[model samples]
Each structure stands twice: as structure tokens, then as C-alpha cells.
Target chain A: MSGAKPKLTTSAMIASLAAEGHRTSGAPFGHALVALAQTRLDIVGMTADLAKYTDLHVFAAAYPDRFYQMGMAEQLLMGAAAGMAREGLVPFVTTYAVFAARRAYDFVCLAIAEEKLDVKICCALPGLTSGYGPSHQATEDIAIFRGMPNLVIVDPCDAFDIAQAVPAIAAYKGPVYMRLLRGQVPLLLDEYDYRFELGRAKLLRDGADVLVISSGLMTMRALEAAKRLEADRVGVAVLHTPTIKPLDEATILEHAAKPGRIVVVAENHSVNGGLGEAVAALLLRNRIAPPFHQIGLPDAFLAAGALPTLHDRYGISTTAVAERIKSWL
Target chain B: MADPSTVSRRSNVSLAQRAWRIRRNALRMAAVQGQGYIGQALGVADVLAVSYFHALRYRPEEPLWEGRDRFLLSVGHYAIALYAALIEAGIIPESELETYGTDDSRLPMSGMASYTPGMEISGGSLGQGLAIAVGVCLGLRRKNVNAFVVNLLSDGELDEGATWEAAMSAAHWRLDRLIALVDVNNQQADGPSSRVLGFEPLVAKWESFGWHAQRVDGNSIPALVAAFDAARALTEPRPRVILCDTRMACGVDFLERREKTHFLRVEPDEWDAALAALGEMPA
Candidate 1:
């Protein structure tokens, strides 16, 4: 074979995308997992032939003995993780959010959640992150997993939250379905000095004009929007909710109860049954309904395009979020 | 308690005696409710006896022992059969059989891991057990824990694609310690399993999937014992499957001869006659 070809940088490959200039936290899942595996001998990495995509290849390379490649079988992947959990092994299973929430929902329900097995389902491409259309994007993953009892749902904002969540969910006994932000995932939570506590929400910025509540990638956008709004004198409070299920109700109510503060729920998921609906229900039940609005994808199969176009079209991009908040104000 | 080797060395006569007790317990539990998957319980008694008494290495007192072999009941409706075996193995109390299918009873009509001791999985939906067994076997091997994973599923379960998926993975992983016992009772909810879903050439199917496959008379104590022995003796790095050919009702002649024994609802008067045919006095 000839000399190794120079690898194409992520920026060079997806140059037209909005994620070009931002510094990635460096595949937090793979790096954090590899670091975690060094200490926790029981932690085993598994994937359904998406190891490289889900960033489980990092763990696979570090500890080849512990990683299991279940091929393209999502059901088997989840079932095997459940089995490993039964045998006192903590299995960190990686796959696409669509496959985990849709393809292997029953296995996740019966084997892992129903049985309350200690299996961490860390899936990539949650919500509008993937531009590969409806088939690849898991826009309603949270909605699907929300109804499932005994399942901890985490939607990490960025690489820091993902890094923190890996160890946190691992230490917490039971099943967790964590949406991953893979590849060159942006780093944002560190700047805000945010720490991912399992079920609690983190208040990144405080403002009186609008309380911008968000999770996953939307939180990143919400923070960016908040900063831009400050220049325009639109005070926005950003409450980053990493844990969607067992949602941080106390903090949500505290922020929502404030007068003259418009409560806006932003998420990278579908408007139906995700953070928006969840917060709406919480507010409605608690009788703390301020001027409310939800910023998320429509209740339909998203169209295929690049990440930037999809985010802009779905109104989850930083620019879209800032403009929406400005228009509402 | 004797080791698995010593237990396996026990005569077929003793194993047959154990099978009779297991059948009687199932009968007792079913009679208490006046209905259950009695046919399945009675039919699978021989395999359960061979597994719990001879083939398996488990401490009945310590159900969660790490080194113990796991037995997953893939067919949830077969909870009666597993409960009977668990009772015989001393994992559960025999008195609990009276409270079968009752409120707050450990012996539910269907098997649930949360409620029942010695139940490896909460099997209800068909085709889930084999996949779980594959994972358990792989986990055990990784930990260097020498233990076998015995997955007991029905012929009806073969219709599930997940079962075939798991079969492929088990073989691909070379899990020699995994053994799948398919109870081909030929009965299911819709009707006969064959008509519901044709899983015939089942032996060839399993063999083609890279498993050491065999077919044996499930109700026959000697045959089941021999099959279990042969499966355990295979030193090759390949999973094993024992396709057990069994009738709906194996012990009670009346029930065995009855049509639609899948979910047999015996008359109150027939209870005594059924027990009498099995050489057991009705309490």
C-alpha cells in the first residue's frame, strides 16, 4: 500500500455546516469512557456496528477485551446489555437515538427498564443533530423514553455535560437513556461553570426579561442567544436541563413563577412530548403559567439537509433562537 | 448438595422420580386455580427436572450466587412449570403453591423476575429470553465466571425474529456454555405453532446458524438427561440447542388425551381423577 492518505478534517469535510469554526470538546464520550474504564473494571462498552459513529471506538481501542460489537442488531445490542447488567456488569451501550428509541424500544423496556437493569444507553444523533432526515434523526426519542418508567433520560448540552453524565449515570444504579452529541461536539458548559447533576437543572445565566429553558443542543443555542440578547438589553435567564425525565421541577417552577418573565422552552427535539410539553404540563399543573412559548421542531418528520439548514429551518439555531426571543420580547 | 457432575451421574430412575414430583406440583398449583397453562407445565416437567436437579450448578439457598448457572424461562406462561421446579429444587416453599395466581403471591400466573425468586428474567413477550441469555453468557465469560446459561423457550417463540438474531450472535461469539432448550409442544395462542408460523426444519435452521443442534424426546427422562449430557460434553466453542419434542400433557393421561390442552380448564370433579392417574392423592 502507498503512504497513508492525509485524513480530512471535520471542518474541511462539512465546511458548509455551522459547526465549522467552534472548537469541539474532542469526542467526550469516547475519551471520558476510556478514562472511566481505567477505574471501573465492570464498565463495558457496546455498540450495534456504530462504534465509530457513537464514539465507542475510543473505548474499544483502549480496552479491546471489554468492548462488544453486536453488529447492526439493535435488539440484540440492548438485550445483551441487559444480560450483562444482570450479571453485575455495567454496560454502556451506544447506538443511534432512532434505533435505540424505535428499533429496540421493547428490549430497552423489558430487559433494561422494566427489570431496572444497570445499562447505560448512550445514543448519538438525538433530535435535529443529524441532517440525514426522519430515518436518522430521533426527534421524539425523549417522548418515547418519557413514558417508560424507571428510565433516566439525559440530554447533555455539550461535551462537558456528556463527560460528566458518563460517570454520573454509571455510578447511579439503574437504566439511563442519554442522548449523545458525537463527532466534534462543541464545549459550552465549562464556560458557565456548569456541572451535570443527574436530575437537577443548572442555571447558567440569570435575567428578568425572558427565562429561556433548554436542554441538549438547544441549551447551547439558548446560551448563545442569551449573550446576543444581552447586547440588545433583552435579559434572558438560561436554565440548562440535562436530565429530561425526573425533570428538575423545583428549579423550573422557581423560574416560571416569576412575574413579567416569559418562559420559553427550547430543545433539539420535537415540540410534542419533549421538554416543551413536559414544562408546559409542569407549569399548568403547578398553576405557574407565565407568558409561555416553546421553540422546537414541528410535529412532523423533519426534512433532510445539512445540519445548519436543518437547525435554521427547525428554528433551533442560535440566530433563530435569538430572533424568536427578540420577536417575542 | 452434590456438584453438577455428581448430580448428572445420578440414575435416570431418580431423575424420573424428580420429574414426577415437579409434574405433581404443577398439577397442584393449576388445580388450586382450576386453570393455567397446565399442559405446558406438565410437558416441560422432565426438562425442568433434569435442569434443576442434575444439569444446573446452582445453590437453591443462594439464588443470586455469581457462579451459579442461569435458567431463563422465555415463555412467561410457563411460570407454573418453573415454580414447580423452583419448589422441588428448594428455592421456593412448596406451601406457596396453594397461593398460586393469588393477590400478593410470589407464584403469579405469569413469570416476573421482580416477584419470583430464581426467575432470571421477566419473560412475557416471546423471543426475548435467548437474546438475554446470549448477553448473560458473554458477560460471564468476560468475568471468567464459568457458568452455563440455559434458555428455555417454546416452539412458538421460534417465530420471533429476535430469537434467530440472538441465535446468530451466540454462535458468532462462540459461547459454548450457552444451551437453548426449545420446547416443541406444537401448541400456541392462535392454534398449532406449525400453522401459526412454520419453524420446521428447525434443527437444520439452528445447525445452519453455527450451533451444535440436537432433537430429543423431551418427556422421556432418559432422553432429556442424555441430551443434556451430550450438550455439556461438547468441548467445541459453539453454542448448543436441544429441540425437545414433547406432547401437551405428558404425565396425566386424561389431560394428555384431551383436545386443546394448551390452556386446560379441568372440571372440579376431574381434578381428583387427574391426580389419581398421576398416582397422587388430592389434598
Candidate 2:
């Protein structure tokens, strides 16, 4: 899919993903939201003209009357969601990550987060997920939303996490911003039998050489990299931090406190203010600094290309992550 | 055509009196703060009075009643005005008026939904209220709840691009239950609204966006009452906007004529005179 049309619409992007044999995790979110709506009538879905792309079409198809199409207005999408929440209704707002973090930041900040409204802002195309370019790829969404008070940020690794997070965020009151994996997302964590608990970091594998702290798609890559690294006899432990805010510090510290362990934080976000900076700060504050390194995007706008090329170029692919860990070891 | 001067008919005398009390309550609250957005409060008092007393169907004691009509204060700085109206409507205690803008008071300097009981949104950031109103109306429609959403904004808010975005969506959604009350005091923080940003032909802007637009004397209790009635009675699937052309500090003659009254710093002696000008004296 390299050198494909750069300006494909969300639907066109999804079709391209299908052509490439990639499945979307948006299916689980849409399906889970619909299933939740079956028992909880207060669940309402909203989108900024990206329902089909974000897999909100599933919810729309299931409950057409309950879905609201707010054209291409991200600000109104957030503001309206906040307003709906004010009326004692839980609104699941879907849009691209860039639009939510960049275009509608203030609305999310003031109307939703300030009031601690129960608005679930689930955005697709988070961090380097889109091959389209910086416009579609939200590489710094976590950093942007990290500073916001009373907002729960989640970076789901696969379909299983996305499915469980939908009901979990709905049940837990207040505002939440979750990065979405759209259009044929790889199902990996379920193979590991991972159960996503909010604000809890899960230790998938334990090794002595290098401890890889990861979240979102980076975790999937880390898990794959660890398997390959095992063939090389490099002992690697993977700690997946799904919830970025209200981080599971005790769990992270317990795994990272060991001496002689190279602590590498992997993320699909920017090197600044993301999981890398967060873990670095935590280690520095706790005086548990091992030989630490961050594997993520550079602090700049990424070039446009296909997902495979971009992932390799940005050093987040399975092979790239494996090679980096091998070199560090 | 009805004469503008005698627009107050016999039937609207009670509404006019209610407007007067709202204005007095605002004056009292402004006195508590020593200084506040008293001019905008006075200008929008009649609209708030008609909204709470005549137009809206809210259970005053039960501020969060699901079946009640929602009134969003988009211009959060004008919270003093809404606080006065809420107190008059019994949604808030009359004693709390003295605690306005004080420490630990529910009534903050700006209108916040988390802080104030009756406030539908935290509206200090201008240009957010209408978009939120559109969302509320859409949510209400989905729930099969028959309720109106009245968004009260200032002329300065028109400068915000997001407000126009909401306007277009509200009309596109055919949200007849949404009512926008734009207080055109023609004054903003920087300078006059016209000087800062020209929003003239404001009614045409709304009508072109497919809303039932009406320009009314915001200070006239009769005009406000009729506009609210006409807005509610419209059966068309179009949003309604009552463009209220009002004088800042309207009820009191002296304050109404004062220049630079957007955020008035009332003198110690002037508080009593301002109250007296509204046909009341200090208690």
C-alpha cells in the first residue's frame, strides 16, 4: 500500500486497510458501545462525519435514532457531547485523534474535563497509525491530553482492550480520552489473555536483561520483539501501561527497580511528554535510573507515506523495535 | 405596528415587574462584589426574567429536573445576571446573593456548571455555549424528551468562529427546540462591538443560516415576552434566535447612560443612588 493516495477519506482508508489484510479494532468499540446501549439507554454516539471510518457506523446501524452526525465540526462534536453529558446522558464522541487533540482542545478542556462530565472522547488514528501524514496521525495526542486535569487517557493495544475499555469507561463516571485503532486492527493482547484494568499496568513477560515499558501499539510491537529477542537469548520483560494518566506507579516501579536492567520506554507517540518522558521522570524522582532509552517518534512532524514505510522510518515496527533492543543489550 | 415606547401592554405588567425585581437583585449582587459585570447583567436581566418566569418550564426548587427546560449562560462573565435571576426564581437561596464572588461561594466570578446548581455549563470561555446548546438539544431529542434549550450569549461572543459553526449545525439539524438569545449591547472588553468586530446585519446572518430570527428590544419586558412566545410557538423545524438590542445598565437611568459600563466600578455613594434610580432604596 506504499505510495497510495495520500488524501483518502476515512472510508477509503478502511478499504485500503482491508486490501492490505489488516483488521480494525474499531469493530469492538462500535460493537461494545451498541451492546452497552442495549442495557444502558443513556449511551449516545456522536461523530464528526467519520462514523464509517471510526467504526461508529456499527452503532449508527444498530441505533440510528441515538447516533448524531455533527458534520466535520470537532469543536461542536466535543461541546455537544459535554452538553449532552450535562443533561445526564453519556455521550461517546468519535473523531480522528488530530482533530480531538488539536482542533477541539479547549472545548474538551473547559466544557468536558473542567466539569468532569461523563463524556467518552474516543478518537481513532492515534499516533502514526495513519500513513496519510501528520494531519491524520495524532503522534502527540497523549502529550496534549496528559496535562488536562480529571481526564482519563487510555491507549488500547488491541481489539480486546478496546472492547473491554468501552464498558469500563462507561461504568466509571467522568471524562475519558482513548486512542482508537481503526480499520483492521491486529488482535494480539487477547492471544496473551490480557484483561485490561483501568489505571493498572499488566506485566506480560518477565526477563532479566531489559525491561520494556510500553503502551498502545508499541506494546504490541514490544511483545512481538520480545519473542524474537528470546531466540537471540536476550531476556526481555514487557510492562504494558494502558492507562497513561493516574499511572500504575507501584507496578512500574516494581518491575523497573532492578539493577543492570536496561529500561526502554516504547510508545507510538512523541519522545516528549509521552510515556518516555513520564517513565523517565518517575525513575529520576524515585532515584531508580537504570540505563534508560526511549523508542518513539522524533519531536517533529512526520513525513507522509504508507503505514509500513512510516512505521519502519519512525522505529516502531516489530523488526525495528527488536533490532533497537538487541543493539541496546 | 406597535409603538416601541408603549410596547408594555397591560397583560405584560407582571412580567415587567418581574424584570424590575431581577434588575434589583442584580444591583444588590453587584453591590456585594463592589464591582462586576453589572452593565451586562442589567442589560440581560429582562431576558433572564422572561426565560425563568415566563418562557421556561423548570421546577425552580429542583434545578436538575430532567423534564425542565435548559438555559445555558454562554457569556460566563454575565453570571452575576443569571445568579440574580436564579435567586429570584428560587433555584438558589436569596441569602446566597450576598456570597456572590466570595470565597467558597457556589456563585463564582464566572458561571460554572460544577460550581453553580442551575448553571447548565461553565461558560466563561466565550463562543462555547451555542455549540453546547446544540448538543443538549440533540441529546434531548434522542431521549424523546420534549424540552427547550435557551442559549444566552453576548454580542462579543459572535466574534468567535465556533459560534458560527454551531449556528450552521443547529440549523442543519433542524433543531426547533433550540433558542439563541444574543444580547447585542454593542460593547466588549477591547471596545465597542462594532469597533472590535462588525456583526451587523446580525439577524440576516442567523436567518441565512436557516433560523427563525427576530430582533427585539431586550430591555422591554413586553418585547422579550413576545419574542419568547413567538419562538416557542413556531412549528417549523428551524432553530430560533432572539437578537436582543439592549442598553447596558438599562433599568437605572444614570447607569444606563454611563460610558464604559461593561464592567462598572460602582462608587460607594453610587450604589444607593443606582438602587434609588430603579425606584428602590437601600434596605
State the lDDT of candidate 2 residue by residue for A91-168, as single tens digits.
999999999999999999999999899999999888887767778878899999999999999998888888888898
Candidate 2 docking class: medium
Give the lowest summed-lDDT range of ten residues in model 1 chain B. B4-13
As a whole number from 0 to 100, the lDDT of residue B28 in candidate 2 is 91
Give the best candidate by TM-score. 1
Instruction: Give the CAPRI rating of model 1.
Output: medium
- Two-chain DockQ for each candidate model: 0.78, 0.71
Q: How close is candidate 1 to the true structure, as a TM-score?
A: 0.95
Q: What is the C-alpha lDDT profile of model 2 across B1-283, one tens digit per residue?
A: 6432122222344766777888888889888888888888888888887888788887766778788889999899999999988887777999899999999999998998889889988999999999999989988887789999999999999999899989999999999999999999999998899999999999889999999999999888788889999999999999999999998888888887777646776898798899889994322
